[model samples]
Target: MFSRAERKGLRLAGGLTLGFVLCFAGVAAAVLLGHAESGDGGPLLDPYLVRVARFTLWQAALSTLLSVALAIPVARALARQRRFFGRVWLLRLAVVPLGLPALVAALGIVEIWGRQGIVNDLLHLAGLDNPVSVYGLAGILIAHVFFNLPLAARLMLAALDRIAPEHWLTAANLGMRGPALFRLVEWPAIRRVAPGIAGLVFMLCATSFTIVLTLGGGPAATTIEVAIYQALRFDFDPPRAVLLAALQILMTAALLGLIALIGRPDEEGATAGRPIRRFDGRHRRLSDGAILFLFAAFTGAPLIATLTAGLSADLGRLALDPLLHRALATSLAIAFASASLCLLLALPVVMTPRLADRGGTDATTRFLARALPATGSLILLVPPIIIATGWFLILRHFGDTTRHAPAIVAIINALMALPFVVRVLEPAFRTHLARTGRLALSLGVTGANRLLRIDLPALRKPLAMAFAFAMALSLGDLGAIAIFGADGFVTLPWLLFSRMASYRTADAAGIALLLGFLCLLLTLPSASAEPETKGRGNA
Candidate 1:
């Protein structure tokens, strides 16, 4: 459907994506092979590795099951109560955790459930001798649920919203009530979408880094990602790090493949043009009210604690601290650079011509054109720690890796943000092209002229939104920073984590609140304007 120029654009875009992927793979291979040649090669399946892997799987499974199971009642309650006050705000709050930095959220959790936190303080005031500990397995599970439960509830709530009004009417006419109504109408809706949500949550929990590190408490709670970090950073054992990285990649790939087989939850095509009148859930106000109140409290308590603790912190002193200023400046610089890089990388794939336009193209060309975006998104399957480990090993051979740590971290952060940038930009880019591509072509406009004069102006808003999201994501990331942070290379999350690890709770709480506020501020522009219907069942 395009002139010769468009095809050339497509080819260049495809080549760039392929080259990026190959460069990453090449670095990883070099690291693994280099270590194998020099180190005393032992079997990959050491006892510790085996134990960590088993614990990783076990925790992820339990986390997924709990998040989904708990989401059911919350979602069902929201679905039935249609016109309650503050409902929209409540829904918006459910998405706040998605944008929060894991470490910030972990700090928030600690402020609520730690030994000196509100819960334990209340218990002590009541003359109870027992106090709570927000560390170890309990801490990990609580943090995971705090982050993932709202996501699961939102997805399940969206599924419930999709059920037809006709079905509800039929059930009512048949005198269906309570268990019977759920059996006939609700269960099927949840079942259809539950598998995909479970898999997504499982993958997330399995690859968890910041939460695991913050709450792990000891070696018994170590995850594969943490093990890889220890092998490289603490032991200086590249061979072992490489082995663990390879295992993580293999396990994640398997989970992703299984998710594909189960199919994605139906997230698109939600209609808000008309309202549905519901016949059920009219007489169960007491139960539904209790459910809603409990979940709201569960999700809201930590955030409230964070805010209260942060309010009591000495912000004036923190402002004058050189370390905080340096870390803040570094984080801003990295966020800006990474956001720009991600947009540049995502544009080509987003602008690739659709396959339907390949009227005269050969099969191979069409296939490559279609595969380019998939390749870009496939970067998600390779955990950021794995990429960082590979590059860290490679840089060690040439010189001190510390010198290049910040730059390396920025690149990995950009790559991790690529999938989100693509998701945000692709739809808007495609829609703009569908409207203007033929017109621009007919006017003999192509390449820079078309992009500058037509596409850019029309897509300015979405492009900005994508940039903001990418920037926020990079700013909050701990994965790459965890591997690279050192004396002269501290970022905000790194500094905050150090404070928390050293038992400087007051300073940590201040930094956590600051980081959380920054992320929320960056996310507001997009969140306010975007429709709630999009990405309904997606985490």
Candidate 2:
């Protein structure tokens, strides 16, 4: 527990986090109003964009429902079992999607579900004119299920784990099975987590960018974020871009509101209910085995496809592409710089969270820093293409389009991703500082050296984790790069998109694999950090 000052600081931190999230949500809401004057490419509440939104809504809802629904059975089975071969592996797989880059996953989906991809190739040998449709609505749903099922399973399993072992014993004694067992043991778990899972999957689908873009065949299959991209990047219509940003904001906000209304009624004691027992009967064995197999297929196929393609390819050719190399270097540089920036900013924020509090921050500074991230996010929420267009317009007026635009994109990318870094690192920062503040002061350590010697040693894990996460996110990004990417400022993911558009499946597949591996390498360090660092005091 915090002392009064500490409590005030923690409150401020919460306020700031909420405020930041809400501000972004609000900006996403007024997209229509902002782009009311987006001439030419302006949405004008057009049928095309409306169709896109509707499709996004339908596909995402279905995906969310399927994922959460399927997760119930899978979760229950896992919760009931003891440690088994590949059990931990499956749980880890459930969490792998959490680390998945959307673009990478899309590529894997194509390989498995694409027309000329594996499934289709097999189908062709079987003499089918057309194989499965990995395009349009079908493609979008496949990608979502592929991505969200693991998350839902993980959540549901966590929820079901709450059931007490005694419950299972009592059920056995009473001869409970089937619906009776489900009602007594499962429904409660489902009720507790259903709303949250729904909200998570829904928001994920709603705000989707990469999956919809890659899998979506065209404008007919677009999402709001993609729409914002089209208006700004493709058309350079500021008002339209603003309007789309607003619409996105509103839709995202509405989804979040739904979450709040139907929020996880059972977040507390999610694992309070039961001790997951090993299978003791044929029925139990069958149910558990089926669930494991279903989820394994859902979660494992993408990785297998990616590994097969990536490892089987001409990586040499892919790497030789100058643009690919440039993007790789650029991603690393920005990731490093931004990671440093997050650490610098987070250290202060965590140590002095009171600054975020109305009581602590001066009204003026609070207002300034509080809203500063948007200065960078201005590209996205306001439309990146609009910002680029306005800047381009200014340059054109001055007849100086020669100014470096790619630099601007890199800066924006760093800024846009900064908030995420801050969000992830700030908690660990506060927790550490609050607990170790006196220890550090008593040891007479302060300033830069303090960070390296006193703080960094303890913070090495989260620090590494935050840096890796920021880098991985930045690496997979196409948003900022797209605006300034015209002159070939291509990142690996961008390159893959280009290849896909040009029908270069082989090359695109290779790049996707490379990019996925790169992202995983960057992310693994941080993922590995959490278990290694926490609640430990060091000199």
Candidate 3:
């Protein structure tokens, strides 16, 4: 549909994006490998490293099991009770925790389970001697479940929601109820999604940094991500950090290989779709109610606690704190830059293929088109911390590292958001081009004129929504910043983490509240725009 010049520009832009990904990513990988070969002068598998790896794997496995285990019944309950009051809102609520900053959730968990928090207060009133501590392995499990259970449940619920209405009718007509109904109908739907959801939850828990860092009371509970941070920041041990990053990359690659072998579930058959009419769960209202109540309490407590704790702090004084303002400004700047960069890179990458198909059909163009989108997933294997670590080493080789913190953090955060951005925008762009590309070209609408008059106007909603989601994700990010954050380079999460570390509970609460509020504000626009498009495990 494009004129020759426009298609050429698109191809050029796509090539540049591909080059950007390859050049820097290639350099980062090479640096890490070279460092790994040189060694840290310490034994490769010392007792501490072995212990940390064991704990990391153990916690991830346990967290995955608990999250998926609990999510099954909750998802089943949601699918069964389709017409209940607040059902829509309950599903919306589940998405909130997923978008929320990890530090905020960790703070919320602490408010409910910490030594001087609500549970302890209740125990003291009841004459109990020991207070429940949210400061070790137990705390880690709780935090991981709080973040991942909703994710697993939402994914499973989507699968269950897609079950053909005729299947339910068949089960009901057969007088199938309870275990028999599940065995025949529901189990198959849940089973299809369960493994993929489990793998995602496991990876999330495995790479967990802020949650573990906040809740890991000491070395006894530390994960590899946190250990890497300590190695670089505390011990000033770049060699050790490089080693940990290498180990993490290898571990992640192996897990990804396993998931690839297991493969994704086939897409459900086309059906006469509508809201599920689960007739068999009629005899199980009491049991389903109990299940839902437990799920709500388990998930809702942290949210309620986060708000109550944050509001209980002195708002006036907290607002006036200069450091808070500075962090807020820094975070906003970074988030805005990251979101813009994400779109800038994503738009050309997505556009190149459509432009290519219209103008040319060469093997090189086809290969470039296919490969550009997959570049977004590269971050999965080499996460933000490792990227930051690699860049940290590179900067150290040149000069001061702290000076480049904001730019590096923004770039990494943008890359981290790239996959989601591509998912949201690619479909919108494809549809828009299919509908209007020919008509616009017929009218000689091309180049700057077309983009301003046709493309921007037509694509405003998805663009805005994509921008908001990317900004929210960047605003709450702690991984890249944790590696590069310093006294003058603090963001909201880094500042809150520092406060919590220094025993400033009240200050930390206020920061958490502020950060949470900002993230929520950014999330609303995206959620409203494309609610159905989410919870597909794209994040």
Estimate every model's Cα lDDT from 0 to 1.
0.82, 0.65, 0.85
Q: Give TM-scores for every candidate, taking all chains together and pairing residue i with residue i.
A: 0.94, 0.80, 0.94
Candidate 2 Cα misplacement greater than 4 A, ranges: 1-44, 121-130, 267-282, 354-423, 439-453, 528-539
Candidate 2, residue 163: Cα displacement in angstroms equals 3.3
What are the per-residue Cα lDDT tens digits for candidate 2 across 1-539? 23454445444654564454345434433444444654565436788667867877888888898878787778777766655687766766666666667878888888888876877888899998777998888888888888888777666665555556666677888888778888876788578767877887887787677788788888778887787677766786667666655566667667766776884363433234443463444567777888789779867888898888877878888778887788677667755665565455444444444345445555644654455444333333433333443444344445535355545554445555555666666677677767776676666665555667867888787777767776677777776555555544556767778888788877877888888888888875444221111111110
Backbone-clash count (model 3)? 0
Candidate ranking under lDDT, highest first, comes to 3, 1, 2
Candidate 3 residue pairs in backbone clash: none
Give lDDT tens digits, candidate 1, residues 493-536: 99999999898888888898899899988886566432243334
Best by lDDT: 3
Task: Enumerate residue pairs that collide in model 1.
Answer: none
